[model samples]
Every structure is written in C-alpha cells, then in structure tokens.
Target: MSKELLMKVLNHEDTNGQLPWIPFAGVHAGKLKGYTGKEILTDSAKLIECLREVYRLYQPDGMPIVFDLQIEAEILGCELLWADYNPPSVVSHLFDKEKGIPCKCKFPTAESGRIPIVLEAMRVMKEEVGDQTALYGLICGPLTLASHLRGSEFFKDVNKNPDYVVQLTSFCAEYAQKMADLYIEAGMDVIAVVDPLVSQISPKSFSKLLHEPFKAVFDYIRMKGVKSSFFVCGNASYQIKVMCETYPDSMAVDENVDMVAAKVITDQYNIALSGNIPLTTTMLFGTQQDNMKGVLDLIDSIDNKKNLIISPGCDMPYDVPPENTVACAMAVHRPDEVRSMIANYSSSGFDDIEITIPDYASRDKVYIELFTLDPEQCAACTYMVKSVTDIYDEIKDMADYVVYKYFIKEDIARTAKMGLKNLPTMCIDGESVYISIIPDSDELITEVTKRYNKKHDK
Candidate 1:
C-alpha cells in the first residue's frame, strides 16, 4: 500500500487524495539503533539495523538507502573528515585553480570507493522493504560534486573561468548519470539528484551553467524508466522556475522555500512537490506537539494534495527526538486524530533558556560569527563557512571569528537571542551581515577590514 501510493504520488497520479511521506533519514537513522554515523554508514549490517528501526518507528513511504554525498567524492580521490553524528565532509580536493584537474581524474565505476558497500546495502534494503516502501537512490548534484573536486574555487570560477567550470561540471553530470545507472540496477524506485548548493546561485547563473547538465542527467534517469526528483536545500525559492525547466518527475525543496509558492512552479510543469518542514526550530528543538502541529499545518496549507509528499525540509539531524518524528508520522498518517491530540499546542516554554550575546561596541577586535546547520553535512553551510575560511589568514590579526552550529541545543537558543532568521548566516559584531549567500573572498576581506579599522579608530 505504501509503495503503490508513493509511486502514484511520484508519478504525479491520483493517490486517492492521500499525501505520501518520505523522511530523509540519512545518518539520523543510525541514531535510532545506537550506532554512530561513521559506524553505520561503513558497515552494511549496522546501516540495515538502523534503517529497520526507522521503518518500525517512522513508517515512511519512501527513504534513501544512504544520504552521504561524500561517497562519490571519496571515490574520486578527495580526502574526507569523518564524524560520529553527521555525514563526513571533504577535507581535501582533487584540484584547484593553481593546480588544474589531473589527467588521471576520471569517472568512477560501480566497484570504486564505497559504491560496493552502498550497493550491497541498497540491494538488501530493496528486498527487506521494497515490497512496501519506495527506496530512493540519492546521487550528488553536478555543482556539489564539482565543489568536491575543485574546492571552493569552483564558485569563484563561475565568473573568472567559465570554460573550465563547464568542463568540470560536464564531467560531474556524466558521473551522476553513471551513478543513476548503478542505483537503478540495484533496484531503486526513484533517483534524486540531491544538490543543496543550487540554492546559493542566482537563476541566471543556474540557467547559464547548470541547466544543460541537470537536464542531461534527469533525461538519462527518465530514459532508464526510473522516477526522478531534483532535491535542493537552503532558500531556493528564487530559482524554482528555472529548476522546473529541467523537467524532473518531482521537486523537493527544504524548509527555506515556501511550499505554496513552489507548488505553483512544479505544478506548472506537472511535477510533484515535497518538503518545507523546519528541521531545527521544529524537528530538533521543538516538542512532539510542535512536530504534529507542523505536519498538520503543512497539510492544511495545501489545497491540492494530489501531488504532495509531506517531509522534513532536508535530512533529519542525528539527535532529533524519535518521538518527535513519530509524532510527525502520526500526523501525516492520521491528521484528524493527531489534530485533536494537539489542538491547543503552543511553541512557548523556552523562556528559561537564556542566551547572552556579546557586546559588539566593547569588543576591541572585530567579531565575525558564522551560524550554520553544521557545515560538515550541509553544502550551503560548507561553502558559507569556507567563504570566511578563505579570507581568515588576512583578517586573523584584527578580527575574531567563530562558527555556531544550529545542531547544538545551545546554538539553537543563541539563534533566538541574537534574532537570527536564517541558517548559515555570517554575523559581524552580532549583526547579520550575509544571509544564505556566500560572499566572495575579496568582498569578505574588505568588509572585515572596514570593521577592524573602525574598531581601532584608524
């Protein structure tokens, strides 16, 4: 019943007016079974255990086999920094502007890196849950894969060296197609190009650089007779129309994009819509009542439930209370029952969680604080942090820099105290300077320098 209903929604068909649900479990699945992300992601047995626990607890209509985007990068020769909670981050790149991409750098085969491990897990999960659940095979998007191979220089090359950027992203698109083929062979019901970085660029940049690569990979997936989805995180509302032009079977945006507004563009192309559940404020920090209310509210906001799949904005965090997710599942499955269960729900009661912000005027050095949803796991947060890291050496003498991860309960409280409205924001002297967008090195240095000079009265 779950698989059939999910396929109907993914296929943009009538699901008897029932909206499907897919929680991007990812590494968070490991937490349910008492396994660390590093332990479960590497060991098939542990990964399976965690996934089974998720199925038992959440009863998701669809779920990804593995959500780590670093798999392809690790295979392609990038060094990774592993974590116990979050997915690994690429610590080293294959190439940069100073050193061009090596001739030896080529596409990965099915046997490369951890593909065998992931494929083995995928095959088994298909047999374990495929009868009732839709298994999603998530492949890294071209822009993100390019960032892995070329480091942060990939973003700067958009303006400096367009031709080189094209060549690299073209190669990445080919890699994505091959990955889709492997996932299809392993019996994946859907192939999602999980490219969170798409939210950072402008619509014009996407049209000029990424349009063809995205279209090519999605076209390949469609030809293979597999349902496809374009999954993006951060605030991607601005480029929703351009993203639709690529023509995926469905489009999933995170909590940042308005679902009502996004549904209009996706519906224009007859594509199904999924997501916009707040991961931090609601899922991680908010109570179970808040989670139930969120799911119910999202369901109420959408008049057309024909092509909607209720889900979190992005991947669920490591310690997002299982009861909260259970609450979400109950709301999605039995909205009326859950609605009565939490009719008078209020998100208050955090009044006692005190957070004292720093005094900007009294500080001798210019202060720069980066607020993120853990850069290690989030593509947008990774580059936004790198934007500051790229210029840190020059500003070290005059500016004090720190990163505040929203995953921590303390940081979540700090967000409310500091009046932060967005994740992965850069604040200078307690003021939000850059929102979701990553600033270029030159501009970052200039801003820090101006602040430092003002503080010194020079």
Candidate 2:
C-alpha cells in the first residue's frame, strides 16, 4: 500500500494522498546492521540483511537498492578507493579526453564486476519489500559516468571540444540504458539516473552536452513501463528548468536547492519532485526533535504538497541516528501529532560560531583554496580537485598555491566565512574562480599566473 502511494505520487496521480518518504539508505543501510560500507556493498547476504534492518527501522515508503555510484564505473575499469564508512570513490579513469575513448573498454555484461552481487540483492529485496516499498535502482548519470571514464580532462573537453563530450556522454547513456535494463529485469520499481555532476555545469552546457543523452535514457525507461527519476546532489537550482525539460517522471535534488522554488519549475512540467533536507545539519548532527521540526517546517513551507517526497539532501550519512530518521517518518505519518510534540521546539543554530577567513590581498603568496564535500567521497569534488591538481606540478613554483579541503565541521564554518555557496569551488586569493564547474587546466594556470604576477609584481 505504501509502495502504491509512492508510485502514485511519482506518477502525479494521488494529489491529495500521503507524501512518500525515501531514505536513500544507500551505504547507510549497512550502518543499521553493524555492517561496514565495504562489507554490505560487496556481500549480497550482508546487503540484504542491512536493507531489511532499514525497512524494519525507517518503514520507508521507498528505498534505493544500492547507493554506490561507482558500480558501473568499476565495471568499466575505473579503480576505486573503498572506505569503511562511506561509499567507495573512483580512484582511476579508463579514458582521457585528448586520447579519446579507450578501445579496450567494452560494454559491461550482467556477469561483470559486482553486478551479480547487486542483482542478487535486488531480486531478494523485491520479494521482501516490493509489496510495501518502492525500490529504486540508481545508475550513475551520463556526465558523471563520463567523468569516471575520462578523468578530469572530461571538463576540458566540455569547453575545448564539446563534440568529444557529446560522444563520450552518448556512449555513457548507452551504458546507463544497459544498467537500467538490468535493474528493470531484476525488478526495480523506479530507475534513477544519479548524475551529481550535472549540478556543476551551466544550463547551456547541460543542454548542449547532455540534453539528448539524458532524455534518451529516461525515454527508454519510460518505454519499458518503469518510472524514472533524475537525481542531482549539488546546488543545481540553476539547471532545474532544463532538467525538467528532459521529462523524467520525477526529479530529486539535494540540500542546496530551495524546494519551493524548484517545485515551481518542476510543477510547470507536471514532474513530481523529491528532497532538499539538510543532510549534515539536520539529519546527522541534529536531534530527533530537530528532524521532526525540519520535516514539519518543510511540509508547511510547500504550498502544493501533492508531488513532493521528503528526503535527505543526498545519500544519508553513515552515522545518522536511527531515531532521527524515525522522527522524519513520524512527521510524515503523523504530522499533527508531531506538530503538537514540537509546538515549542527550536533547533540550536550554528550561525553564532565564529569563522576566520583568509586575507587574500595582504598575503604575499598566492592562495589557492579548493572547497569540497571531501574529494574522497564526492565524484564532482574529486574531479574538481583533480582539475587543480593535474595542473599543480606545472604551476607549483610559479605561484604559492595551497589546496584546503573544507569538509569537516570547522571547515564548513570556514566555508560560510568565505561566502562560498556551492561545494567543490576553486578560489584564487579568496575570489571564487570556479564554482561547482571544474575549470580547464590552462584557464586555471593562467588565472593563477596572473594572480601570482600581481602578488609579486613579476
């Protein structure tokens, strides 16, 4: 019945019905059952056990089969750096922008790399929860998979050779289709193209480079009689309208976007929408009351609650308290009761914390600061950091360059101090040079060189 409610909401059929709650449990499912990220992701039995635990605890209306974006990348030959807590990060790429697609890289088969493990898990979960909860099969988005295959040079190709990017992304879309087909066969109710990288580019770039490829994947999913969702993780407010134009059944966003405003755009196309809960501030660090109040406030803020599904900004962190998630579920299930419980409740705000910022003009050395959500876990941040690092050897001595990762509590405060709004930003002397979008190597070098010359009067 809950799964039917969710599917009805996704299809925009039940306007007056209950709003679904999808936890995006991903690797966080493992944390619920005393399993590590590496353990549950690699083991089918463990993965199943963990997911069962999640269903028991959260009572989610929907849940993703697996949250790891690197499944396809790993199969296509990208090496990964596995972690105990979070999903694994891709550590190597198979293709280079200048060299073109690697001839040795072939399409992934159902027998290839971890697909067997995932398919096995999917088959079981469909049987276990298919009656009550909508199951999501998340495929790495076209641009993100292209970045995994082509490395940081993928962005360079976007500016210097768009035709190449189109070719690469088109190829990636085929892989996405294949992955989607596999999940559909394995009994996925919803096929989500998890392309966090799209949040980094402009709407124009998205249209020029990714429009058809994305549309193709979603269109194919539609033809298969399965619902589709386009999920992006960063501050993608700028691309919402264009994203809706691709015509996925739904669009899911992270904490960075304003749900009300995004919903206005999504509603224009009659696409159902999900998400915008703050992952760190509310889910991970805040109390149960905080979670409840956040959900209630979100529910209240949206004038049209018809097509909205409340979820964490992105993947749930590994350590989010089970009770906090329950609070969200409670608010969704029992809003009036929750409202009275939190009638006078207020969350402790971090706005009072002091943050020291860099003195760009007074410093003698050119300061190059890179802000990210940890380069290790986020692919967009990884490649954004890579764009600078790839050119570091060439500009190391030419300028006083330093890269700082603002992923921790203190650094998050510092990010606020620097007036940076987006993750994976490149700042030259405290000025935001690249926001979300990765810069070309030559552009980065030239900007750094100009800044260095101005600093030393060279």
Candidate 3:
C-alpha cells in the first residue's frame, strides 16, 4: 500500500508483518555531524541538518522534532543547564525558595525563547521529510512542566497544596495545547506529551491530581485531528490502564516497563504500544551484534507488533554509536542478515571494569572526581567542572578534584569502572554526589565544608 510509516503502525491495519521502528535520536544527531548541543539547538539550519542526518541514517518510521523536554520550561523562565551531547537539564525552578511560593512569571508566547527555533526547525524539517515520515512535535507534559517551574516543590505541593498544583497543571496543559497548535500548523503529524516524572507518583495521586489535566491535553490534540501519545519513561505500569483510558491515541513507555507485559495491558484497551529498547546498556554501549540480539529479544517479547512501534527506551544518548542504531534498523528490515551476524557474534568481557572506592576518612582533603564526555564538546561538563573551580579558591584547603575527559567515547572502560550511569557525575570521596544535575555553588560548598569538618571532628 506504500502507506506512511507512522500511520501504518498506528492503525496496524496491514503493515504486511513489517513492524515500524522509531529511533528516539533528536539533538543527539548533532554528535554524528561533529556539532555540539549548543550549536545545533540554537541554529535552525544546523538543527534541521541534524534531523536530516538522523533521517538518512536511521530512517525511522517516525522521529521527534526534539527529544528535549526543557524547551517549554526554558520559555517559562526555568534556566537550563546545557550540555554538549544531550539536551539541557532544568537547574533553576521558577519559584522563590525563601518565600516557599511559586514565583510570578509571564506566560510564554510564540516569540518566547527558542520556541521559534523549535517551530522553525519543525517547519524546515517537514519541508524536507514530512510526507515520507511522521514528524513528531514533542511537548513537555503538564506535571513535568510544573516540576521544571516549581522544582521538587511541585511534587510536595501535590500533597500539601492540591489546589495550587491543579492550577499550575491546568496552565501547563493549556500551554502544551498552544504549542500543539503551532506544531500542527508547522506540519507535525504527532504530538507526544513527554512526561517522565509521572512514573514517580502513585496511581491514586495521579488520578486525583493529574488525570483530568492530562486528559485535557489529549482531548485538545484530538480536536486538532492529529495523533496524541503519552510518553512516560520509567516504571509506570500502574498508570498504563489509566493512560489508555485518558484518550491518547497511543502510549509509549521506557524499558523499565516490560514491553511484553505492556502490550498485554494496551491490547485490552486497543491503543497503540511503543518503546522499550534499552538506551545505555544495549543501545549506546552495546555492539552491533548485541543490537541484533536485543532487537530480536524485544521482538520476541511482544505478543504482536500490529499497533506497536519499536523504539528506544529513552532518548539515545548523544554519543550512542551510530552503528548500534543502524543495527537496530537492520534487525527490523534485514532480519536474515542479522541472524547471520548473531550466529558469529561473541560476547564482550568487562571483567576488569572496577574502580576502588576511595576512603574519604583517610584523606586530608575531600576528593571530587568529575566524569565528563569531552568538555570540548559538552557545555554541561565544562560548567560542572567550572562549578568546582569557581569555589576552589575558597575550598582548595579542604578539597581536591580531577576530571575524566571524553568519558563516554574514549574512556568507555573508565566510564564502566566508575559505575557512572549519567554524564557529568560528581564523585566526592569515591561516592557519587550528583548525577547529571549540577548542584548549586552554595550547596556544593556546604557539603565540602561539612566533609572537612567531619574529618577534624573525628
């Protein structure tokens, strides 16, 4: 029938047993082109080029315009801590910590920071590949946006201040709908409400505080005659039934939720199912042979892929080897070849991947090890390493630190040895203090002093 890839998978009417594969690589595509996160995200031409490269490489049935959840948060006054390989992480919430209240902020508009960049990128991408492949307009889900704006306080507020959270969530949903309108106009065929935080709360809490707001977002997308999907990565098994009932055309979950089990749940509801490829262990670090094995395993686990879209569990890390992703696509399109490769493939050994934990009590000065993926390419690592430097003048007497450069690409052995899961991890006295998140200067200093004081007190 030569139907569009996404629609074929969404309806599952007759793909002729050809399961659609979607690779969740967005800004990470910039890495393949030697462009850093900052350069590509800021320049629409570069961003479009990155997307084009991804389309040419992976040839996904559907692809997200952006894998970043920080765009809407950025427009709403939440400051992002930018990185080289991955999307920016929200650092400063739009709330007054001292006052313990939500800070007043202006609503974001089309002219807001980077919204135009995103919308422009989508328009440009559609002109290039819209008719052939499904272009996804990714938006931050309401609870996630609220969390970005209000920080963890948003979670606490759900309990202590349900009314306040209800109001904030409503605003986020409306904001998402506005972005949805812009995306639909820009030629996006799908609206994915990406909300990873939803996994942290209970079903009861979700039903009480979040269900209606989320339902509204899906309802709005339906009114636009576009597909709406709820993307909740993490173990969100409890909400699968609720999500199917929430009115989204489909639901995508991460590897934490078993795809086979998820399929069983979604099957009963008759909604579409997608996602489950492991990002780090199998996708980023695994070899092509491993890729085939993992893909085959995922394919076997699902009862049926009729309405299922095979995809990575989460955003493919910025440095995920291109070959691994290509292998995944190969597993889908060239299964005979993959079967042959799997027959000859041998397992890799990591028997020596271990680093001795430092004894903080034995050291005179507190030791901090900052693991990074090339400061030359990664702004997040650059700033994180600098976070220590800026305070070194004051804490030098109490602490010492070192940096592991190109930690993901060149130093895979060391990365594995450190047991580091996220980039720019801050290890203090052999204990990881922060993963991906750059702690505030004051907070970092206080911990340093406290460690020093503990040494003297003993």
User: Which candidate leads in TM-score?
Assistant: 2
When sorted by TM-score, best at the front, the candidate numbers are: 2, 1, 3
Error of 2 at 437 (Å): 1.6
Taking the tens digit of each residue's C-alpha lDDT, what string does model 2 give over 376-403? 6677788888887788888887655555
lDDT of 1 at 207: 94
Report the poorest 10 consecutive residues by lDDT, candidate 2.
96-105
In the range 1-458, model 1's lDDT, one tens digit per residue, is: 29888899887788777878888898999989889999988998888888888888889899888999999898888899999999999988888546365343467677888888788888998998898999999999998998888887777787778888778888889999989999999999999999988888789988998899999999999999999999998878888999999999999988778899889778878999999788987898889999999889998998888889998989899989999999898989888899899977787835677788888999988999999888888988999998878777888998888899877778888977888766778899988888777777777888988988988888
Model 1 misplaced regions, further than 4 Å:
97-99, 102-105
TM-score to native of every candidate shown = 0.95, 0.96, 0.78
lDDT of each: 0.87, 0.86, 0.77
In model 3, the runs with Cα more than 4 Å from the true position are 1-3, 96-107, 344-346, 349-351, 355-458
Better of 2 and 3 by lDDT: 2
- Residue 30 CA displacement from its true place in model 3, Å: 0.5
Looking at model 2, the pairs that clash are none
Q: Which has the greatest lDDT?
A: 1
